[model samples]
Target: MPSDIHHPAAAFNRTSFEACVVPYLDAAYNLARWLARDDTDAQDVVQESMLRAFRYFHSFHGDDARVWLLAIVRNTFYSLRSKAAADAKHETFDDEAHTLIDEAPSPEARALISVDIQALQAALENLPHPLREVIVLRELEECSYKEIANITGQKIGTVMSRLARARERLKAELSSSSTEARRHDVR
Candidate 1:
């Protein structure tokens, strides 16, 4: 047996690790997929993150396993991102000017609007990384602001702020895409 096996406070048992951490494998991989923007790279990130998590499992305090694992995933992603090609540059999105009002379209207007999944996916891909992350965590993962903050190591207020900006940007991008498609159809 390992020398540290007898520590009662350490939640490092393999059984506990499987119970708490294994269930969230999809969530971890989904997050990595979005951040890495490539299936192969995302797989690599999740594998590395799971290894890191297991190696440090002794330190886990038995909090929300999803959040803890995601934080590890986030760190691993940035580490990988940093080591990627120098062509990757930090980008700032000016969302303030691009903000569009959120209004429900009438049935008639809705009928005229056409948005394909590919365009929506492209718009999501176009969002800046920070905004994309918050959107993915909150909207896709259904995480609360507090959970998102814990996962991202941001304050609750910052998470709220980012979510709002991300939504606004996404809406604007989708609306513009719809309009462009309409014009092309008319031609």
Candidate 2:
């Protein structure tokens, strides 16, 4: 019986890649979904990112797989966005129609869910891409400043500044929303 040593390299590659990258799948998909703003687009972006990561896995020498994977995801998203931009024609955005509204869930449904995830999602979505990306990386992904800086290819100072601005914007938006809701309730 001849032992198959030829398949060892393939097994090693698959195992190592899985160990390094599998844990960050959710984070990658979340970041992709946020950036792409559509489940289908996000899935596509994540798939592309994974393919690119596997192809260039040899270049990955870092300790933090999440940051590295996120960096790839971010780069892939921007590349897709850039390509879309190049192909884009005139398209007018209707702000009024697209504005996020806080709709009250029915009494039965409200009893089961307490937190309003949609409002936060909408607030984050309304932020500019850079600001939103920083917030998402820091808050949602729970990445450290240095990790975010590395992933974003920005200085730590820039990441901190963007995070600060993102927080302020989110606060203001949420506060204003609450105030409007209160006014509506009093009417």
RMSD of 1: 8.1
Candidate 1 least-lDDT 10 residues: 93-102
lDDT of candidate 1?
Answer: 0.80
RMSD of each: 8.1, 6.0
Put down candidate 1 lDDT per residue, 41-159, tens digits, no spaces. 78899999998998788789988999999889988999988998888643333333223333596644443442445556677778888988889899878888999999999999999
TM-score per candidate: 0.76, 0.80
User: Which residue pairs in candidate 1 have backbone atoms (N, alpha carbon, C) closer than 3 angstroms, thus clashing?
Assistant: none
TM-score for predicted model 1 compared with the true structure: 0.76
Across residues 1-187, which tens digit of lDDT does each residue of candidate 2 receive? 6534368875787688999997899999989877777767788899999999987887889588889999999999999888886655222333343344445866544422322344566688789889989999988899999999999999999999999999999999888776655554521
- After superposition, which runs of candidate 2 have C-alpha atoms over 4 Å from their true positions? 1-6, 86-116, 184-187
Which residue pairs does candidate 2 place in steric collision?
A: none
